[model samples]
Target: MSRRTLLQNAAIAGAAAVPVLLAGARSAGAKMSQTAVAYQGSPKGSSKCSNCKLFEPPSSCKSVAGDISPNGWCKIWVKA
Candidate 1:
């Protein structure tokens, strides 16, 4: 292949690989530590895990590691 053709093909391949790499990164979502989000066992005002969008039912959180309490509060808490 010519030098220009080789570079063009490489660019195209790199562009194609970008979406795959981004998809993998998006799928591999990492949760933050409780301390990183300033998580507390008790609710902060009206904000609580049960009312937060990231809170999973029972005793878990989608964005916070370890068992989460429904009455707990965190800096990342978003209203449901």
Candidate 2:
């Protein structure tokens, strides 16, 4: 293969690997803190973390860090 073609292929491979590498690094590092996030006070008329699929029951979240509240709300909150 030409040098330019090889370089382009390597660049493409590297770019595709970026996300996977970052994901692994993140999973190995400290988790995100819910305190760092600005959660909404009270549910949006009827939406809350508890009812959300990401909710982890009691006080935890699947994608959020720190203690999660069923009554709390966040931007990523989704209906369960």
Candidate 3:
């Protein structure tokens, strides 16, 4: 019951709760619509979601749901 032990226990508990919290948050937003993002062709570097690191092959994005275009661009687009 020392101060260090209490802090350690608190840290362990907090770490253990992180994944649960993240899972809940993820599920809470699981219904988000991909159409809301309104992806378009990038005007800056001509970058597309297909070339992004978050892009999932065959028409999907890690951050986007539904059918996504290879040439589509969004606000969260990042270079691969």
Candidate 4:
């Protein structure tokens, strides 16, 4: 294979591996939040999602800007 072709193949392989590596990293960090224990409150009360007040849906968590299980909670939770 030409040198350019070999380099291109290596680059493509590296790019493909990146997603797998990231997926593994995400799974390794798959853990529940500690905020569910109760409102410990952020050190400055600024990290609590419950205090943000912009958290809509009232049931969905807005802290992560993703699907946050209701069973879990975060410092940014706000009451509706």
Task: Please name the candidate that would achieve the greatest TM-score relative to the true structure.
Answer: 1
Instruction: Kindly provide the TM-score of model 4 when superposed on the true structure, using C-alpha atoms.
Output: 0.38
Q: Name model 1 segments beyond 4 Å from true.
A: 1-27
TM-score of each: 0.65, 0.55, 0.52, 0.38
Per-residue lDDT of candidate 1, residues 1-80 (tens digit): 89999999999999999767645743688666889789999999989999999899999998788999999999878889
Where is model 3 more than 4 Å wrong at Cα?
1-32, 41-44
- Residue pairs that clash (backbone atoms under 3 angstroms), model 2: 34-65
What is the C-alpha local distance difference test score of each model? Answer: 0.87, 0.76, 0.72, 0.49
For model 1 the TM-score comes to: 0.65
Question: After superposing candidate 4, which stretches have Cα over 4 Å from the reference?
Answer: 30-80
What lDDT is obtained when candidate 2 is compared to the true structure? Answer: 0.76
Which scores greater on TM-score, model 3 or model 4? 3
Higher-scoring candidate on TM-score, 2 or 4? 2
How far does residue 76 in candidate 3 sit from its true spot (Å)?
Answer: 0.7
**Which TM-score value belongs to model 2?**
0.55
Candidate 4 lDDT over 7-33, as tens digits, reads: 999999999997586457446754334
lDDT of 3 by residue, 1-80 (tens): 99999999999999999768655755776623465556764433677887788688888877667777787787666799
Rank all candidate structures by their lDDT, best first, as comma-separated numbers: 1, 2, 3, 4
